[model samples]
Target: MKTLYIVRHAKSSWKYSGINDIDRPLKKRGIKDAHLMSKVLNKMVDKPDVFISSSANRALHTAVIFCENFGFPHFNLQIKRQLYSFSDGYLVKTVNALDDGFNSAIIFSHDHGINTFVNEFGNRPIAHVTTCGIIGLKFKEKHWKNIRRGETFLVEFPKNHK
Candidate 1:
């Protein structure tokens, strides 16, 4: 079995009006929530073998915080522009390209994309994947390429702790 974490990028800052959406950084609340979610994930299960995120600033920052808490090196995180898109098929392709040697992975992305990605691999209907939320899925397939729908094992949202 292989495990995957579908994470919504942490809350972003709207403080800078002229800043591009892709360039927007995490807000203070986002930073706090990232740490909180990381602590929660630390107790959930074995750490993911790899971390991946959209190259967008908010998503990448969120991934970095989570990877730090998970004790994963920065070099292990993969950044893909496709992850910023809401295309479910593209997200699947990204996951399919992973090395079979890695048993688990965490993918940080934006709202609609994160929501769509989780539903692809889960039995439940997740209306929204809130910022810093983590949805865990465990597939029966041995290889990432064969991963399909599986049991939704976990759902952790920042509000749940607040």
Candidate 2:
């Protein structure tokens, strides 16, 4: 079985002047939320074997917090440039290209694309993925290449908690 954890980047700070969207940092509430989500993830029965994230600052920062709370080394993270503002197809391709050794993986990225990606492959009909939210999917296949649409067995988000 394969498990995919899709997480949207935490809320970003708009305090910086003329800052690029990719360079935006997380807001105070975002940081707190990320930590809370991380704690929740740490209690999961299936921990991710790999961490994949966009190179964007906010996404990368959110991934870092998850790594810290989950006791995973930062060096294990794989920053994929294509993850930044990529389409749902691109995101799915990226995921399907991941190493087969990874039975479980975590992907941290933005909205719209993230929402589309999950909705396309997962069992749920997700319209939006809020900041610091997580969507978990379990596939019956052993490899990413075998993953297909409507194969998800589970779905979850931080917002669903409270």
Candidate 3:
């Protein structure tokens, strides 16, 4: 069995002048929410073996907070450019290429793709995946290549708690 944790980057700040969308930093609320969600994840499951994130600054920052709070110091995170503004097909391909040695992995990226990826694999329609939202999926397959639609055993989001 394998597990995939899909997380959308925390809320980003548009308050900064002349900041590109890809370089936008997390808002104050985003930081707070990241910490909260990290705590929730620590209580729910063991730390993931791999952390993958989009190259975007917001996504990278969110992944950092999750790693710090979970005491997962090993930064084997890969910044996938394809994940920057890709569709669900690209996201799925990225996941399917993960190393089989990793029993669990975490992916931090943007919306739409994250939302669609989780919904497709989990066999459920997810509304907006708010900033800092998380969707945990348990798959029966050992390799990412074997993951298919309706193979997920769990799906969750941070908003569900509040």
Candidate 4:
């Protein structure tokens, strides 16, 4: 069984002027939500074998919070520039390329791509994945490349907890 955790980055700040989308930092509420959600996730599931994140600041920061909550070393977290993409094609390519050695993985990324990927690859139909939200999908296939729609095991959002 292979488990994949897909997380949409926490809310980001638009307060900065002339900052690129990839460079935007998380807002105060984003920090609180990341902490809250990470604690909730920690209690719900075992730590994943690997944690991966988009190189974008917001996504990387959220992944860091999860890593800290699970005591996964920061250096062990993998940052992929290709994951910075906003399209599901890139997301799909990333998942398909995951090393078979790791049975479970977590990916922190942006919205449209994350939402599209989950809806396409997961059995559950989520209208939208809020910031700091987590969607866990389980696949029956042994290889990541062969993974098809298996199960939507967990769905958590900050609003539900709040």
Candidate 5:
């Protein structure tokens, strides 16, 4: 079985006027939500074999929080620039290319892409995946490249917990 965890980046700050979308840092509330969700997941699930994130600032920062909570090495986290794309095509490509050696992986990315990917890949239909939300899927397929629709084992969001 292969487990995949998809996380939408925490809320980002728009306070900075000239910053690019990829450079937008998390707001204070975003930081708090990341911490809370990370800690919560730490208790609920096993640490993933791989952690991947969009090179975007918000996504990377959110991934960092979860890494710390899980006691995973910061250097082990993989950052992919292609994951920054808003299209689910990139997300699908990134996941389909995952190493078969790893049984589980977590990916931190943006909205529309995250939402679209989950709806396509997960058995449960999710209308939306809010900021700091997490969805855990378990695939029966042994290889990532061969994965089809899988079971949604978990769904966690900041609002539901708060």
Candidate 6:
């Protein structure tokens, strides 16, 4: 069976007022939350075979921290620029294009799309997925393209722990 972990990028800082939305860095709270969530998932969730994240600064930073904590190869993570669009349809297309070599994948991106996609593919309803939030779904099928709304195996975020 294929498995997927949908992750919302950690909170971003607006301190750099002139920076574009795509270039905002993480806030201090975001950094801590990312660390905590990474550690938590490292212990509880199965390792993902692939790691994909939006090329935006905030999401990319979160994915880097997660890869370090999860022991995933740093170079293996793909920074996709299109994921920044935050569109569920685009995200699904991205998933469908994934190679079958990996049975599990970690997809990190922004909200609205992540939130919408999760509610679509996840059995449990979510009002919103907080920064650094992670929801794990277990697909009944073995192929990525055949994946649909499967079982919600885990729903975790930093607030729940701290």
Cα lDDT tens digits, model 5, 49-158, are 99999999999999999999999999999999999999899888988999999999999999999999899999999999999999999999999999999999999999
Tally clashing residue pairs in candidate 1: 0
Please provide, for model 3 over 1-162, each residue's C-alpha lDDT reduced to its tens digit, 9 standing for 90 to 100. 888889898888998998787899999988888988888888988989898889899999998999889887745667787888757877898899999999999999888898788878886677777889888888888788998764555555667665
Provide the lDDT at 97 for model 6.
Answer: 87
User: Top model by lDDT, which number?
Assistant: 5
The lDDT of each candidate is 0.88, 0.85, 0.84, 0.94, 0.95, 0.90
| Candidate 6 lDDT over residue span 23-130, tens digit each | 999999999999999999989977899999999999999999999999999999998998997678878878888899988899999888988888888899999889
Distance from true location, Cα of 80 in model 6, Å = 0.7
Clashing residue pairs in candidate 6 (N, C-alpha, C atoms within 3 angstroms):
none
Q: What tens-digit string does per-residue lDDT give for candidate 2 at 1-162?
A: 888888899889999999898999999988988998888878874668999899999999999999999988999899998899857766787789989998889999888888888888887787778898888888888789879864555455666665
Badly placed stretches (over 4 Å) of model 4 are: none
Clash count list over all predictions: 0, 0, 0, 0, 0, 0
- The TM-score that candidate 1 achieves is 0.95
lDDT of 4 by residue, 1-162 (tens): 899999999999999999899999999999999999999999999999999999999999999999999999999999999999888888888888999999999999988998999999998899999999999999999999998887999999999998
The C-alpha stretches of model 2 lying farther than 4 A from their native spots are 150-156, 160-162
Q: Mind giving the per-residue lDDT tens digits that candidate 1 earns over 115-162?
A: 777887799998888889999998999988998899999999999998
- RMSD in angstroms, candidate 4? 0.7
TM-score of each: 0.95, 0.92, 0.91, 0.98, 0.98, 0.97
Q: Give the Cα-based TM-score of candidate 4 against the true structure.
A: 0.98
Better of 4 and 6 by lDDT: 4
